[model samples]
Target: MLNHFVRVTGLSQSAQMGALPASYAATSPNAQGGKYYGPDGVGNGALGGYPKLIDPHHNKVVADKSQWAKLWEISEKMTGVKFDI
Candidate 1:
C-alpha cells in the first residue's frame, strides 16, 4: 500500500516523512476552526492507510469489473467462504 501511494503521488519516502508534522498540525482542532478532525482533508494523512487502500485514485487492486470478480473467486476458493461483492 505504501509503495502504491508513493508511486501514484510521486513522493519519496523522506518527503512523506517530512510532511507528517504539517499534516498533523493542519488536522488539529485549532487549525480546523475548532471542528473535529475529519476525512475531507487534501492529503493522504487525513485518513491514513484507508485512503491508500480504497481511494479511487490510489486503488490498483483490480483494473475492471472482470478482475474484481476474479479476485473474489480466488478468495472464495481459498477461504471457502462465498462473498457477495
Candidate 2:
C-alpha cells in the first residue's frame, strides 16, 4: 500500500511538475519529520517535530488532517509541486 502511494504520487508529481531537477531528485527526500499532533487533537503548534502520539483516538499522526495540511503547505513551498486535490 505504501509503495503504491509513493509510486502514484511520484507519477502525479512528475506529470504536474515535468522533469524534476536531477540534483534535487537525487538528494534524500524531506520526509524525515514535521509538525505533528496527538490523537486528542493537541500539539505544540510548532512545525517539524514528528509526534509520539499517545492519544487513544489515533494510532498514528497520519490521521491528523490539520497537521497534514500544514505539512502539505511546507511541501508545496519546498518542492514547488501543486495538485488539484
Candidate 3:
C-alpha cells in the first residue's frame, strides 16, 4: 500500500515532511506529544508525516485530485472493495 501511494503520488518513500525529530518542535499546540491530532482528537491528522514530491527547483509538487482518485481506484481494485472517495 505504501509503495502504491508513493508511486501514484510521486512522493518520497522515506523523506516525509514532519517525520524528522526537528519537525516535532513545530507541531501545533493542539497536537499531543508533538503528534498529529484530528478533529475531535480521535484519529491522526490527514496526511501526517507523508512525504511530498519535490521538483528539481526545490518546489513542492502535490498530486492533484485526479491523482488522488487514481490512487483510490487502485486501492479499491487491489482490495476488492469499493471506496466512496
Give a tens-digit lDDT track for model 2, residues 35-78. 32222212431221222323233446657778789999999989
Best by lDDT: 1
lDDT of 1 by residue, 21-74 (tens): 456556544453332232333464543321112233353553467777787789
Model 3 lDDT tens row, 1-85: 9989877874543454445423443554433452422222112223334322223222223336676677778989999999563
* Clash pairs detected, candidate 1: none
Cα RMSD for predicted model 2: 17.5
- For each candidate in turn, the TM-score is 0.30, 0.28, 0.31
* lDDT score at residue 47, model 2, on the 0-100 scale: 20
lDDT (CA) per prediction = 0.51, 0.44, 0.45
Superposed Cα deviation of residue 79, candidate 3 (Å): 0.6
> Which segments of model 1 are wrong by more than 4 Å?
1-61
The candidates, ranked best first by TM-score, are: 3, 1, 2
Please give the lDDT score at residue 77 for candidate 1: 100
At residue 85, give the lDDT of candidate 1.
44
